[model samples]
Target: MIGGCAPIDAGGSGGGGSDGGARGDGGGSTGVNPLDNPKGTERGLGVIKSAKDLAEAIKIIEKVPTKGRGPKTGYDRDEFGYAWADNAEEIPLAHNGCDTRNDILARDGEKLKYRSGSNCVLVSMTLDDPYTSKTIEWTKQDASEVQIDHVMPLSYDWQMGASRWSRSKRVQIANDPLNLMPVDGSANSSKGDSGPATWLPPAKGIRCSYVVRFAQVALKYDLPVTAPDKDAMLTQCR
Candidate 1:
């Protein structure tokens, strides 16, 4: 469950049947491709079907160095910044008078409803959850059905190389749109700090795109994943 999921028309786009806008066909949606959405500000994870794109994806993954995971000696959620802060430096959508959570909700969701007189707090929406390839018709009362997931999870960041990063830099990565997605809460929960070696979208066709997105975040922060994770990430592009 997440914040602001409730069934209210409020002139918002209505959910499209049981499918909402999601295809729910087991493969990934025909949403934006990872190569086209390097900033991770795009809508959904589409299947990467082109050899050219896959080749580019490989190059991106290859740029990230591999290292053994370090001890999470002092990893705290707060270390990244208070959850969903809009004050993080050098990140998009920060200080926009709305929190990071709401900014993402607006970015990915369709058929959206906003709270009365509030442009930021979404009251309801239809989400094409890329992780599970499911169409989620969510209301404010049923918020947990969807969540904003960190592609390069904060905890994973700690174990990878972020334990040594400065506080402001840590905050930037935490709230960066390049590392975020809105997806099925259950799928997100399953990922819990694991990387490509152990976790990926349930939508098999999205794997290459997912791993590519993961690599984007890693390289952006100059962070390294475990060797196995890097190998797994490279494999997904094939």
Candidate 2:
């Protein structure tokens, strides 16, 4: 069974009530536990509601080394690996006979329907998108309605010194679940390559969790955020 929230009817209206929205709890066992799910195996981007939790999140954010962004020369998505490559090594859900994209969809999506004769191909599912606080009924036909956001954008990584890393390291950062989120398509587009300073989740409640996830990815990869980005991240928790 899927972890977090129950599957909502696809044909139903847009809003699924606050509880239905993706936050602290959604799918069953995966119910939005960002602090605990450091490896990104959990389903939703769980909320950090308590003051103590918020302070702890801020502590993580403060430790992220800060640096100025570098030029975008010699940076390309292919440097990471084939997009959503199933073969990317040294990360969760790799070599599972499924690409990173579909793996995450199955991990977080509810009432999943796979393509005929293929458990790996997700044709449709419901997403309580954390970025916009919306429940999206997504189908393969309307693929852009939902997008997998890189918590740390690849370009930002490049600017922050990923350009100097070996190609294999880039691939791990790209496919790492701690760095990815299936969020509303438009929100993802608007967030292109921006750090926390420039863009944040529209859902006010998830900002702390979002920044914490950002910090987690940065720390894991040994990448640093811009000074302003780090400051903005701390603000979210405060």
Candidate 3:
């Protein structure tokens, strides 16, 4: 039951998943509630303006278990299944016929143009990226301009407790929209596997919302962050 939106009935159907992360059209201009967008289907991570909302976000972050990251032994992208697989179980927008990347693009993009005769391939669109606070006019030809970021990177997850998770669960998190975001390619690349302690979105205004999203993913998967990471996350909302 997401907090801010209408009740999401179970077993709703949608198109294929895309590796592209979440995007926005400023639909949530007044501020989007993370509680309401539990499935990450919403356009953006809205600002947490009210004291009550900030406190609620802090409470969620505080609940996450803290631990130091572990070894990277046997870590690989394939460990979580293929990138943007549409069949990952126990996630929104799975097996809808499109890959996860395209699904996200379609979900958050504006003025979208799909490939001829195919609604699945998003050829171009405008993205209001939250990470860098920039609007990107993205096309398939310059696809790397926008990259899908795992809120909790796969390597970070490997170090955290996902090493013990079943392959299916790993795949689920890897493709889950709640754990992904579409941002500037450079920013996403710079964030490779970094926790909040070390990396944050360049956009100061979105930092709080970014950490809240991180906490959301951590809580959903029963994952832990390092003490420093947790502290950093808390500071954003404070």
Candidate 4:
């Protein structure tokens, strides 16, 4: 219903709910349709539909620039605060409260093995990681092994500019699909709270896309960035 979902195919053996597909268009790379997904992207939600949509989103975020003494200069603070609540709590199973971990489970998990429509019990679910570009062999395991990474770590946000966000804004950042990506557990752990300047994905080729999304989120949220982060993002954007 988020208009961004654009319902491609709800039928698939992978899960009972909607199955996300890739947006590909056989043309120039610039012509790449964010909605032209031929191979499913295991997206947290989906890509922004157009420059206009992206611009609109940016307008909203710019009004809420990051404030305060952000998270520890280097550590990726989970300091996102209230804006993170909606995705972390306000959605469907939100009554009990939503944590970053479970929120991603519901958003990224295929069947969403939940406790009978409640955010209570978390069970097994299939996750096709998009960052590592690998499908994790299906298995039932501990929660730590299966994790949800904040693409722009909350800690990073704290220093970069998230420290000043109102709870409402933080919740928005937490839930925004553009800011979230499902990746390998170990990779997520290793990359914990690091930014483009300090870290880059092991899959070098994906860096362009990765920065693109990061810029999309930062610009959308009006979050601040050091000169290096801005330069890196601009370079990637080009």
Candidate 5:
């Protein structure tokens, strides 16, 4: 849950390479090439349209093993950690005073506005949403308009083998920037823990990027995906 309702600090350039803009097909200004931001420390999920890069994305997807999605029994959002907790250890931007949600907001959004006297609390910003290829000007009043998505949704993580991981490990994956993106709220809600096999971004240009991020998350945690998910991921690039 968000706290601290205060005046915004006005616009400023945010970290995370958002200033690079959407350097991909179609004309818009948001996102960066996923290949360039391999560690996931940067901002925005850029489109991958090059034939050579698409092939590379395919190879990355192929490296992940396949498995049937396990039952969602006893799964809860709290299993990983509290909502946007900043205490998650070993993940980028964690323990950085700002919560995960705000950290990503500053990372991905441009012309960032922070809460009064605090650089860590985001009050407003503009975004070029990769999932829908649209621009959004957002503020605290309608916070839900932008939601941070787990590239590999948490429940999907449990089904993929995170259930067996220790609490700290789970927290790490949960808060890791590499596994997260701020995107259109409705699109994120529609995803609902579904894998690539069942869902992809509405923006065709970003589909390959979405799956590449999924594969990266999977490979990072040594997690496997459902066979169909892997196949669908491969199909995105080709």
Candidate 6:
């Protein structure tokens, strides 16, 4: 989570792209498109299908313990030292048969201008930042401002359970679409390595939906959460 809270330009909301728009799949139709209707949000998976479903999920999520599931404090001089990407360059863009960053850039950016279909270097685009409910005007949308933020920050994963993961498995988790989203630069930076207990989206109205997705992602990845943190998520999601 962001180590300190920062006030943001909280006013204004604008619609940028259609949620129903079609996305490229690398192959003809083999890849899954988010618009095809999100499945696997079953009750057993902590998704809210109804009021009762929400209540039930909240109860289960709240009962989850807290201390053993979070990252180690004083991990270094900084609270977020482990949060920054590690071995990013050595990870090799070609390992996945393509670059993971470009794949996400194209997946998350609109009106993307690509180069030779070999890499995801966008010339222009509009970005819908999920965390702040704001549209970032990306003249070049390049790599800096438009970041593929892990919904659950990686450092949090490393300490909780990922420290033991194999390198390839870690890479897969790093690039998994379910855990990634395009977000505003400042918002993503502010979130750092915090979890649901300490941080959340700036758009207050959508907190329930946001927390629901957080729980789903954590559950899917078999990541653990602290008790207070889990309670906070359930309360927010409810």
| Clashing residue pairs for model 1 | 1-143, 1-144, 2-143, 2-144, 5-139, 5-140, 5-141, 6-139, 6-140
**Per-residue alpha-carbon lDDT of model 1 for 1-238, expressed as tens digits?**
1333333222234322112233334632535776777666655566676678788889989999988989988899999988998789877677777788878777777777888977678889877777787878888788887888999999999998888888999999989988888899899888898989998888877788789889889888998888999899988887
Error of 2 at 120 (Å): 0.4
Give the winner by TM-score: 2 or 5. 5
What lDDT does candidate 2 reach at residue 149? 95
For model 3, state the Cα shift of residue 199 in Å.
Answer: 0.4
Off by over 4 Å in 5: 1-25
Each prediction's TM-score against the native?
A: 0.88, 0.88, 0.87, 0.60, 0.90, 0.64
The global Cα lDDT (0 to 1) of model 3 is 0.78
Name the better of 1 and 2 by lDDT. Answer: 2
Off by over 4 Å in 3: 1-31
Kindly list the per-residue Cα lDDT of model 5 for residues 128-198, writing each as its tens digit. Answer: 88898778899989999999999999999998899899988999999999998999999999999999999
The sequence of per-residue lDDT tens digits that candidate 3 reaches over residues 75-144 is 9999999999988997987777788898777766666788887757889987777777687889999999
Each prediction's RMSD over C-alphas, in Å, is: 5.6, 5.8, 7.0, 7.9, 4.2, 11.2
Q: Higher lDDT: candidate 3 or 6?
A: 3
Q: Candidate 1 — which residues are off by over 4 angstroms?
A: 1-30
Candidate 5, backbone clash total: 0
Error of 5 at 7 (Å): 16
Candidate 5 residue 159 Cα shift, in angstroms, is 0.9
